[model samples]
Target chain A: MNHHAAQSRAAYLFLTPFLALFVVFLIYPLVQSLWLAFQQTHGPSITRYVGLDNFKSIAVDRLFWKAFWNTAVFALASVCIQLPIALGLAMLLNRPDVRGRAFFRLIFFSPALVGLVFVAVLFGLIFEKRTGLLNVTLHAVAGFDPEFPWLQQYVMPALIIAALWLYAGFNMVFFLAALQNVSRDLLEAATVDGAGPLRRFLHVTLPAIRPVGSFLVLLSLIGSFQLFELPYILLGGGGPDNQGLTVVMYLYQAGFDAGDLGYASAIGWTIAILLGGFAVAQRYVSALDER
Target chain B: MTPTLSITPRRTLAKLSAACLTYAMLAASAAIVLTPFAYLLASSLKTGEDFFGSLFLPAGEGVFGVAWGRITSANYTRLISEFDFTNNIVNSVFLASTTSILATLGAAMGGYALAMIRFPGRRFVTNLVLFALIIPAALMLAPSYQLLYFLGLLDTYTGLILPAAAPAFGVFLFRQAFLSSLPPQLLEAGRIDGCGELRLFVSIGLPLVRPMIGAFVLITYLGTWNNFIWPQIVLQSPEKLPLSVAIAQLRGVYSQDYGLLMAGTVISIAPVLVLFLLLQREFIAGLTAGAVKG
Candidate 1:
């Protein structure tokens, strides 16, 4: 009885800091945000219970819908472009016969290590209309006009490119590590049985790395939804005509700019639900595949 | 030994084609990845005239000769003196280091307890941590900002470091590392030697999980250093801002000074690059280890 009592005390002691911090920072904020979602605040202190009105406002708001669509487009485009390229790079770097693999891996992964703000700044320069390097290069190489605004016509694509550059290498490292864990004997046996490289990859490699792929896909999806800095910096926080405004950026603007804390809270809850639903769906899909 | 193996022409062609394709793809990918960085470097080196005139090409006048002329450390000097870049660097370094150490220590204790000691509510605690991980950070923004305001920690380093130090990801990563990498006999031996739980963690558990600790330190430090939005909201004073926020301020104030902007960026990115280069192997190992466990 003493031992059990001592153990429980120790457990609580061990958990105190994390639980305290979580309550103060995470859980309190979480509950408060939900509360704020329902209660309308005129200023910082003026609060009134408005029930579902804030959520209703969010549902009908055109800017909210635009931001939602923008976010969805950004997320989908980023995942579709990044995953296959990262997988292919991982496969190439995973090959035993490849020389200078470490150097290639390092170069590839270098961009990801750089802060997102730096990446945003770099791409911002590159995508500049008149004096930017990208425009200059296009003019020199293909005689393309330098006056064209890359961000205006190609906002999503430009963001997707930046996303791919920053993330593909990082994701490649994960895939490479997962690929390394595939049993060498199985691959060797497949090769010995006259299976081609592509055949071996399809039949053996794909199965072994499927879990990693699923995890990356899910992570990328979540990351895509939370996308903020790159678009914020590159396009000047929602760019021309709010074309670049992602959901998180919109949420930030609403909370900070519009001071619509209640409405922003609704958006936050909506994002959480969407992300959670997708993650659960992905897990289900993975389980079904296993079965 | 008697039979000479001969490759078929079709097989040879297929192999050659595959090799060529791989090379082409890698080259293209590398080009795309490196172009923006290359542009930044080139632009930084070009004269103002060359910057506007031949922006795509390398300047005939070197970085020193262009604009400020003769390799002036002017931009960097200005970055430090005018922007208080030095202070921002110190603030970032201090915040990152403190967060890393506090977070690692907290996680180490939590992870060791969860992994080695059997206690009631273990499953519940683990599930809660996982739930924390899945919850979007944006959800916590408004409330956390308000809480920080209430505590009178707004614009202070404590505001930046404390909220970040309590990240669920660190605990999750450490727990996963402990489960897989830590051996049971060591803990038993420590207990047998009459070592207390805390001592066992400090002496035995810590050394065993050095790699994970290293990994957590890097991830935590980098994440804190690069954080933009939270700091943007919390930090009101320009001097208190980290490099990420400072760089954004540069954008707002000196939007036209591409050279200076790129210089600031290059300066901002240098430490991370150096750290990455030094710890490339450990970084990869840490990432792979985390992914596998997740």
Candidate 2:
């Protein structure tokens, strides 16, 4: 008992430095943000007990809803399009006969190395109406003159394209790792049973990698919800029409831009609740798939 | 049942067509993937006058018309001389390295304790980390700023480094690694040898967690290097801002100068790009290791 007590003390000692920092930074902020959501603040220094006024105001805020919806679209694209492309590429590259596997894998994943901000910055010009490569290519190949403001006009799709370019490779890397773990014997057995490649993939391979797939879905959902830099830069911080304002952007604008720290806290709480809902939905869906 | 000799004309033709289709798909996807990077490189070299002169063709004639343009390094020179590239790069490097080192160190110890030691409320601590994982960081944004301000840490590297040191992912990773790789007998043996707790940890625990430490370091470094929003929110001073924020601000500074902007992006991301390439395999493995385990 004494040994156990001493050991536990030592363990607690080991945990102190990290937990000290974690509680202050991670834990305290969470609790404080929840509390701050219910209050009102003029700036960093000004505070008043508002008693749910911030939340009340947020419920009627049009920009909040717009940011929510825009973020939801990004999340949807990540799951529906980005993940599938990644899975397809992984499946393709996982084939036994594919040549130059290393080269292709590296090429695909190179984009992920570039920061999201850099992607937003680089693609801002790459999609420029006049000097942009996208338009230039379209003009040469199809004899179609490009005139639309790719960033300002079609904000969501353009952002989605950039996201796909950057993240498909990232997801592909993960899926590829997951695919390699699928037992070849099981696949061969299914093949001998006259299961075509598609059916085998659907039944055997997919079932085997479902955990990682669900994990990736969750990961991408979280990633998309954290969408700030891409939209912030690409659309020049919420765009002319405010079509690109993400939830985090709204929080940022509220906190820094408007100096409404309390309202920003409220926005932060809403985002937390929404993300929690996503986690629950992801869990429920994964459970259903498991059954 | 002679399957080996079953390669009839139709079968051969089918296989060939399938291979061709596979190659075509790969090629198309590769093109889409490579286009932006190709454009980034080619345009980085172009003169302002001929920035949009030709799509694939560089500004002047010969060698894709980009030969002389590549020689100038005008954008790069301007980025360093005018845009505070060197300072920003140094700041980013310092911040990222500090955050990465601190986060990894804390995670390793915390992971070691969680994985090895019998302790009170270990489960609670573990659950707290799991909760941290689920909680959206956006929830903490306003409070973090306020907290940092009260602590007088805003706009400082300590502000960035301290908060990031306790990432749930790193904790989980180190714990998992320790659980898998650490042998309890070493601790038992060391304790019998009368080594103190701190010494035991320093001598045995440190070596056992090397793989995870390396992986966590890479991950945290990458994350810190790429981080934008929190730094954007916290660090307002140009000199203190990391590359992520500095480059983001570069857009306002050099609005129409695409070459300068691209140069900044390339320079800011260059170290991370090299590190990512070198450690890409381990990085991918570290990422998937958790999911694959799940």
Candidate 3:
């Protein structure tokens, strides 16, 4: 066979399975879903091209907006809490002198192994209004009544705590690996040049892991958008007054509960747009900081 | 020099404080991560009265006394007799194993092609895989469900296994590993020996990508085992449900039976913990592979 022909044949042969599946499952569905976003649907089947009617409905839908806002808040709160705590833990664990680091690392990373729904259930028990561990401990310590409804009144904070518990260790493992990849020579050189631990970390270590940091930020941002199973299981599918409703949960509800598949598709597309926009904006800001 | 060499109490105290602070933070963080599991274990062993009474304290009481007052094996036994937890476990393990195997095979071939072959559309395929990484699986849920329902495969293992086996992340990871680690001349040498392309891939490529395969298998297995939403939507029958879904059902039905529910939750999470402990090195490598790069 000629070289070009051989190459083509090999490429086609090797790519057959992935290509077929991608077209059938990914590409086709992707296009179909986008189309479904515009078409109005009474049930599972789309009726007609409504030309932004679904989008208009989503724009004015109170529940949809509540979920969107709740998700945004959750994402911001999680990133803020998870990143700093992860960074600190990663730094401490990276220290060569730290004893029992391996054991601590395993303990820290254990929660991520638990399924999201399981964590939600576990936290639900922990945050139970009267008999929860939190209230019980508080009552014993301060002689106060154990009546606070954590999952209901403080839904956002409770959700954040659960998110942090489920994810912080996973993030820490990432940061720890990145820290290991940082050159020890650079750190020692900075220390010898009279830079203290804080200064050296801020100026030298952070700059070295900038790529990893950026990547983590982007991944966390995407993860924040895709928040579903936890909120769905906990707080009874978005809690009291929809305080815990996330965008994806809302989309699921729209499609499954309300039978508005077209509107749900539109909501899904809107999430994609929002995530893309946020990623771009984050990249822009990071680039500006670098410059 | 002599004065610097001498240990001072003040400096010792400062160093001690630093160590204490580090240990304190680490201990507190560890407690927060582990306390929930501890509570779960404790609650599972206690009866309702003891569970309620010792909510915050350690369950110093025996497992048989207050926590497990109804000491009948009904919950555990019922999981087999009535709830089909055993069948769900089998279904989950079977689906995860099949997905892992299929995903690894496809990833090996595609990764080998990308790494060794000078093919057209290589970059295009790579970019497509990366794009798949960003497209949240949630977005695909509705269409995927409808497509499966249309295909009459909604409740079948084939439906669950096949769709997941084609994940682009596995392909991307294996391709990156092959490109970075595998030398190009090995393939050329195999070609010179008159080996056919498929044989070369099977004999040489598969061995070379074993670690990546292991990593992919663990990742894929974890994803499948912990999968909830897709199976929830697709499987209508409880018998077909995976452990994750089954556990959710148990929670829904036995909301008040904290001990039984906690036992079920513990069982659900045990496999994951075991897998993580066993393949932790590879799991960390896989996680780092996804996180440290695009």
Candidate 4:
């Protein structure tokens, strides 16, 4: 055999274990999920082939719609509000004038060390209406009464706040790492050309980190959709009035809680499609932003 | 720039205030980040009564007096004794450690094939890995559950560990690292010296790729350690559930005691937190491998 052919054989031999596992666990499951989406499942087995019924049902399903809306809102907040704050703080830390950069970086990155489950549980206590730390502090410091409905009337805001606290640090670290690579000479050139700090930031620094910036946007978008466990644990059965009920929560309900595996598979496919579109749009926008 | 920096009173004042503002912002952000954890510690230490009656757990019976008094480990003891948290912690450690080690090793092998060893269909295989990475785990939940069920792996560590044991992210990162960094001359030298493929991979390639292994292990361990929903679905027996699922059950009206709940939360995250603190740089690099140069 030629060297290239022999090498290919050796490569295949080396790849056997990974390929086997990946095929059995990841690829096969994904294909099976797609197939499952097309059939009506009673418990675990398929009862009938549902051509377009599952997709059609989701279009009219109010709870499903609500979950989608909630997921969208949370995602927007993550992309728009939380990520910007993280980026701005990262910029501040990246500034040479700042003292104790390592110290500040460690402090900012601390929250991310704790897992999401812990954050959810901690926030359950923190956002509690009565005898909660937030309310007590507000009442003491600002003389505001602790009557705000967090878990009930304002579940989205509450969930968003908790999530922001948990994940803002992770994104901040990402931005910080990106910013560390940004060529200082570019910023200096912008400055020498008479751009002020904000102007230099807008023109030079922003463009320099655009790749990481858009990457963060994409990360936030995908992370926002995978929202579960936190809200599920915090709110307990989708919170009051199902306001905190997220897309994954709805998927979980469909498959396990309600035992409608077919509908659950449909929801999963819908999310994959939605995420693909957002990712494409985000890529386009970022490409345009680069110019 | 220096000509513009004439130290006028206004310019000096502006610069000073900007510095102050920057420090103020950093401090505020740190406070916001730290409060949850501080409360976690405080709540974990408080007696169940104190936890219920007080907002800040260590407050010495009055708001202003807020000095530490009567902090206890009773909650931790109770969590271990009552809910079998020890078993779950062991389960979590096992699941996270096994998956991380296996995933890293598997990715190393696959990445070596794709990057070091020349192969046909390599492009197609790499594309498949990217596709796998893009498909979120939530979307795979139902089918994965059914697959595990059919394989008779449900309620077993194999179910939890096997799915994530050959993760696509690991494969991608290891491939990129090896392809970009590994010297082909070294591989050729090893081959010329009559090292067989397996021996060459172990003696030469694996050692040179320590950082990639570190990255993969950190990322995979962090992910699997914090896994909740997937493990919850598969793990039916309460004793077999990882701390993620066990701690989650401690939420809501089921939360008979805040101290116990917080204690469970503490135990759930303690190992990962310690790991993160020690491997902070590696953790960040592992997470941001594709995005950043480091």
Error of 3 at B177 (Å): 0.5
Evaluate model 3: give its lDDT: 0.77
**Tens-digit per-residue lDDT, A128-237, candidate 4:** 77588887788888987787778878899888888888778789988998888888888777777888878987888788788778878877878888899888888777
List the TM-score for candidate 2's chain B. 0.90
What is the Cα-based TM-score of model 1?
A: 0.92
Each candidate's DockQ score against the native complex? 0.50, 0.57, 0.47, 0.55
Best by lDDT: 2
Order of all candidates by DockQ, from best down to worst? Answer: 2, 4, 1, 3
- Evaluate candidate 4 and give its CAPRI docking class based on DockQ: medium
Lowest summed lDDT across 10 adjacent residues in model 1 chain A is found at A282-291
Please rank every candidate by lDDT, starting with the best: 2, 4, 1, 3
| Better TM-score candidate (2, 3) | 2
Model 2: per-residue lDDT, tens digit, B38-151? 778766766566676666435455575554643457888888887768998898899889999988888888888898897879989987766676677787889999999999
Which tens-of-lDDT digit does each residue in B99-216 have in candidate 4?
A: 8888888888898888888677988897787666667767888888888978999888888888787777777777777776789998899878877778878888888778778867
Worst 10-residue lDDT window, candidate 1 chain B = B64-73
Which scores higher on DockQ, 1 or 4?
4
Error of 2 at A118 (Å): 1.0
Model 2, residue B264: displacement in angstroms? 0.6
